[model samples]
Structure formats: C-alpha cells, structure tokens
Target: MMHNVSHVRFFFLSGFNETVNFKVALFSLTFMSYCVVVLVNVALIVIIILDKNMHEPMYILLCTFCMNGLYGTTSFYPKMLWDLLSPIHVISYSECIVQALVMYSFACCDLSILSVMAYDRYVAICRPLKYHSIMSKQRVLLLACFSWLTPFSISAINIILTSRLKLCSPYIDRLFCMNWVIVKLACFPTETIVNNIVSYVTIIIYLFHGLFIVWSYMYVIKTCVNSLENRAKFMQTCVPHLTSLLIFLITALFSVFNTLFGSTLPPTIQNVIAIELLIISPMMNPLVYGFKLTLIRNRILGGITLQMK
Candidate 1:
C-alpha cells in the first residue's frame, strides 16, 4: 500500500508570542510551572501509594488525579518550553500530529477519569445503605479500567483517522498543533470532519462531561443535606474536587468561546491566561489537598518515613 503521509517540509507555527519581552515572560512562567507540576504531582502520587491509610477509594481517586496532572504536564510542556527558549519555533509535520494527539488524548482521558470520580462520590454518598456493595473494590477497579481505556480507544480512532488525511501546507494558527488548527490545515474540503470534531468537542468534551460533573455534585449535595455526622469531612473532600473541576471547566469554556467567537481578547492577554491555566494545576492540586486538607500532610509524611525504614 502506498503511504499517504504528507510530504510536507516546514511547519509554520503562529507561536504564542512575538516580542522579546513577552517570550521572556512566558519562558519564566512556564519553567516555574513545569517544575512545580513535576514536584507536586510526583509527591502526591508517592504519598498515596506509600500510605496504607490512604488506600481508600477517595484517596485512590485523588492519586489518579496526580497521575492525570502528570500526564497533562507532559502533554504540553517540554516542546512548548523549548520553543520559548529557542529562536526558531518550528515543529515537523509529523511532530505536530503527534503533539496534537498527545495533548487531546490526555485531555480526553482526564475528563473520563474525572467523570468516574464524580460518579464514585455520588455512589458513596447518595446510596449510603448500599455504598459498600455499590463501590466495592471490584467495582472501583472496573471503573478505573473503563476510565483509562475508553478515551484511549477514542484517541486511537482519532489518530488513525487523522493519519489518513492529506496535507498541502503545515502552517498552523496556534502556538502548538491544537486539534482546531490541525483540522484547519486539511488540503481537501473538510466540512464533515470539521463538523464532526466541533460537534463532538461541543457535546462530549464540553456538554457531556460538564453536565455529568454537575449532576454528580447535585446528588452529592442532596445526600449531604440529608446527613448529620461527618459533614466537615464531606466538605473537605468536596472542596478540592470543586476547585479542580472549576479550573478545568473555566479553561475549557474559555477555549470554546475563543474558538467559536474568535476571541477579541488581545493575544498578549490571551496567552497569559492560557499559560496560567496550563501551569496552575501543579500548585493548585497539591495545595488544595495535602497542604491544606486534613490528615493528608501528616499521613503522607508518616507514610514516607515508614517506607524509608
């Protein structure tokens, strides 16, 4: 079979910044974010894995959060930071497709995991009498498996579909190869593909995930209102999740707006917001749970020291 990979030469990037100072600022911010992300996410994963006390479903879900954060960091950071430091900001055509796939694939996976977490919380709370039976170890394992595998299948589908397309030029509008930008570069007329992606993005990525999270929270809240003891513990657990979902939701919603409306927001302002969103998870996630939340810090420390012995 003849390989149809585009014989494209140069991949032109409408990189994040144009001016020297803007580039410098971006470099400083992204570097700091990458470091924080690596340190905190790894620490969270280790803490949860080492601590026997942290082996419950809630904490296990939190551990998956750290892993997802790690995936998120790797998906976007290294190549982007390299571009910031270097003068020539070009990615090979093949590299662009790979990067786009990695970024979106991880993003979709994160959504799946978050949805599982939301449902987990709902089961644990709303169905208290049956909670143990409903969220047994076997069930948790099943949910986890589904969460990781489902998006992976979709990502594979997308990669296979995209790999079949032909390309005339490699000029992409975004700093990186966003799905929107890549689809825009298709040589052939792409109404069906574009519409499919946009509709899927709007419905599944935005609407489905968004609605599920909110619905889960509603059930959680109803359950909480009907309960009496352990109210504070419930609050503690809910707050971190709420914070994570909000950050993710706001960024996704903004991205949708920018794509649909052609954000009149200046590029400087937009890039700044985008950079902050990209890096904020590193600091926010750990601080929200371990540093501020109860039992986590001391338990994590104790768990680490015990492991060393």
Candidate 2:
C-alpha cells in the first residue's frame, strides 16, 4: 500500500451549513464589514504615510499593524464572501493550502508585531532616554520585516510539510482552511510527528511573545505607578496597544479553543467563533487605534473635517 497517496483534490467547507437560509443577509453584512475594514485601515495607513508629522516609530508600527490586519483579512474575506453566496462551499486543494498559509502567517505576524510594539512601549516608557536610539527608523523597518517574514516563513514550512502527507479526508468542518484541520485529515497518524513537533515549537515561540508582552507591561505599569508623567504616557500610548493586544488575544484564543473543542457547540456557533478573529480583529483594531490614540484620532478627524469642507 502506498501510504503517501493523496487522492484529495478539493476540500469541502461546511462552516456555512447553518447560514443557507440567511446567506444573502450574511453576505451583505460581511461585504459591508470588509469595506469598512479596508477603508479604515487604508485611511490610517495613508494618514501615517502622508503626514510627515506622524512618521515616528510608534505611529509607523501602528501603520504596519493596520496593514497586517488588511493583509490577514484580505486572505479570508473574499473567500468567505464567495462561500456565503455559493450553494456549495468548496476550495481547491492548492488554494486551500495557500489560504491556510496566509491565514496562519497573518495571525502569527500579528502577534510578532504586537510583541515588537510591546517592546517599543517598554523602551519608550522604561528607558525614555534611549528610545530614539534604540527604535531608530532602520531598526523599526527591520523589526517590521522580521515580524512579517518570520511568521510567513514558519507558516510556509508548515504548509510544505503538510503537503507531503496523504490526506484521508477532504472535508474541513470550519469555514476556512486551517493547517491543523488539514493535518487532521492525514491518512496515517505516524506521518504527522514532524508536523506536530514543528507546530509545538511554533506555539512555544509565539507563547514567548505573549509572555514578553505581559512582562513588558508589568514593568511599564510598575514604572508608571511611581511617576505622574509616565502614567500619562502609558495612558496615552500603551492603552491602544493594550486594547489591540487584548482584542487580538480574545479572538485568536476563541478560535483556537473552538478548533480544539468545538464539536459540542452547534455548528453555527462554532463557525462564528472560528471566524471571529479574522472578522472582528481586522475591523476592531483600526477602530480602536483611530479612536483611542490621540494623534491618530485627531489626524483621522482632521482628515474627515477637511474632506467635509
């Protein structure tokens, strides 16, 4: 028996099973949401780029974060919209792997960027004198590249490893292609040892990112407690980053848990939780930064007021 035989050519996505009756309504809502996401993120990016005043490292990082949100959402929204409208939800094997890669990398990059942002805040708050020297433009650019490239490389490797496996099934219970879900379809469990090891290493690495964030903020909060100036700085800057981090973690964790133990829930509820990260995080991040960050909020409002005139 050729254990490596891969007969699967397509994957059936059943995440939309419950939405058949309301597909049209869901499509409309999703379409509007996508548009809003694009508009806000692009608006923020343009504001940061055009206004030389907003070219500082922190704002630049925020722009990078918003751009990442756009990248991640772009991978999911179009396919999701198509799935919502189509009677049959199917994705080609190659495309499914690519989509899974993009989705996973996008998420991992988000955490990487957030981790960098946390460090940036830690430096700006804790080591105020050296913030500029430490987070220079060249360095920020390098950090941004690291955030994007590292995760993309990791995800690509995972996808490549997954491609070698012979899948026993072609159905993905969730709406989108996930690496883990695809791995679950492997014909033989023994083929997955490398995949599992790599996945665990990846998780540990990103988990360090989460821990770094917690530690960074602990010092930040403690530092702020002693000084009125630092407290105001923390409120002014750290809050938005904290909010974005909180939103990302909540959505990502829900999806992760859903993937792990969602069988007990109704399919509709499971699907919603599974996709909340892709939908809510993209839309919410821009809104959170646009409203919470004073400079960004002012720039956005100023742009609106100018266009009104």
Candidate 3:
C-alpha cells in the first residue's frame, strides 16, 4: 500500500458524525459548561491572589492547580464547541499536534502539582517548624515551574516523535486529537517503535510520581495518627488535596481504559469516558478546595454575605 505522507495536511474527526441530529443542543451545553469551568477556576485564582492572607505556600499551590485546570480545559472546549456547530469536523495536523501537547502536558502537570502538594502537606505535618523555611516562596516557585516545564517538555518530545510518522489515514475516530491515536495511524508498525518506547518511558516516569504521592500521604497519615493537632491539620488541608488526587486518578484511569478498550464500548460511552477528565477534574478541584478549606470557604462566604448586604 502506498502512503501519502506529504499530502496529509488535515485530519477529519469522524466522532461528530453521530451528533448531527443534536448538534445545537450539544453546542449549547458544551458552551455553557466551558463558561462555568472558566468562571469557577478564575474565581478561585482571583480570590487567592487578592487576599494576602491566602498567599501562603499551600494556597499558592492550589492557585497553580486551578490555573492548570483552566489551561487543560481551554485546549479542548473551544475546539469542541466549534466542531459541534459546524457541518464538517476537521483540524489541521499542526493544530492537532499542538492540542495533544497541551492536553497531555496539562494532565502530567496536574500529577506533578499534586505531588508537590503532598510534599507540602508532609512538611507541614511532619516537620512543622521547618515548613516555612522548606516551602519558602522562592522554593515553591521553583517547584511550580518544575511541575509545568517538565511535563511540557516530555509531551513536546512525544508530539515531535508522532509528527515524524507517515500517516496512512486522516480520519481520527474520536472527538479530539490524542498522541496515541495519531501514532496508531502510522503506515508502518516498525516506524512507531521509538514512539512506543518513549511513550512507555513517559508512563513509567509519571507512575513513579504517583508512587511518590502515595508515599508522602502514607507518611503523613502515620504521623497524623499519633497526634491530635496533626490530625486536625490533615482534615483541614490534606483532605482537599486527597479529594483532588482521587478525582484526577479516577478520570485519568477512565481515559487510559477508554484508550485501550474503548472500541468494545458504544460510541457515546467512549465519548463520555474520553471527556471525563476534561470536564470533571477541572470543575470539581476548585469546588472541593473552596468548600473543604476553612479559610477559603470563609473568604468566599464573607464575600457572598457582603453582596447580600
């Protein structure tokens, strides 16, 4: 079979074919959801920035986490909303690669940020005296930059490798572009060997990130178990982090499973799974933190009450 690597400029997203009958409804819902996501995340970010009392390391991490959610969701929602209303669903190859980069980086950065948060909790509970010195503003800023730059560099490498493949098909079966899906379109399996290696290596690197988070929490829990004050601290600060981690892991696992076994499921179900991370994690993280953390909760409530006055 002859492959036309040079001429493949755009990829057709066939996932929209099933939505023609309800495009308008889908468009409205997607647009509104995107708006809500933006509003909530931005609200949290603003609250944290304006209130100097909330400028501590933990709150700074939370703000970065919300900003990441916004970054991840923005890459998908706008494209999706437009595709929902358009008759033809297509994305240029370059645009698809960029989307995949941003989406994957966003996810990887989420885990990295969570790892940093766990460390912050660990230091706060385990070594309270050194918490300030350890997580100083400069150190937190460095960790935050690491959380973002590391994942983006990794995802950029993946996208670059993916772009080198000679694609046999231009039709992507899903609603959005994904690195693995694009790699599967390669004309020859032998060419994807390097891609596969790098992909697994990336997975292992993040898997260790997951293990690190688990270890930090375990240590924190063990320490908190022996002390009443530590337990209270755990309840107030660590609980929200744990909730966010749980939400991220669930959505991430769904996405992975959908990628591996999705063809066996109905299209609608597959679509839902594909989008679960984008919708649920981004929207729920801020809500969980806003309500669970007393300081943030009081701040939000105080503002609401002032408006009522």
Top of the candidates by lDDT: 3
Please give the TM-score that candidate 1 achieves against the real structure: 0.86
| lDDT (CA) per prediction | 0.71, 0.91, 0.92
Alpha carbon deviation, residue 42, candidate 2 (Å): 0.7
Scored against the true structure, residue 1 in model 3 reaches a CA lDDT of 22
All candidates: TM-score: 0.86, 0.97, 0.97
**lDDT of each residue in 194-250, candidate 2, tens digit only:** 999999999999999999999999999999999999999998899989999999989
> Which pairs, if any, clash in model 1?
none
Weakest 10 consecutive residues, lDDT, candidate 3? 1-10
Q: Relative to the unseen true structure, what is the C-alpha lDDT of residue 229 in candidate 2, on a scale of 0 to 100?
A: 100
Score candidate 2 by lDDT: 0.91
Supply the TM-score for candidate 2: 0.97
For model 1, state the Cα shift of residue 281 in Å.
3.0
lDDT of 3 by residue, 177-272 (tens): 999989999988999999999999999999999999999999999999989999999999999999999999999999999988999999888888
Per-residue C-alpha lDDT of model 1 across residues 198-280, encoded as one tens digit per residue: 43753565368768888998878876886764355467677777777777777766766766764687765555455444566
Query: When superposed on Cα atoms, how far off is each prediction in RMSD?
Result: 3.2, 1.5, 1.9
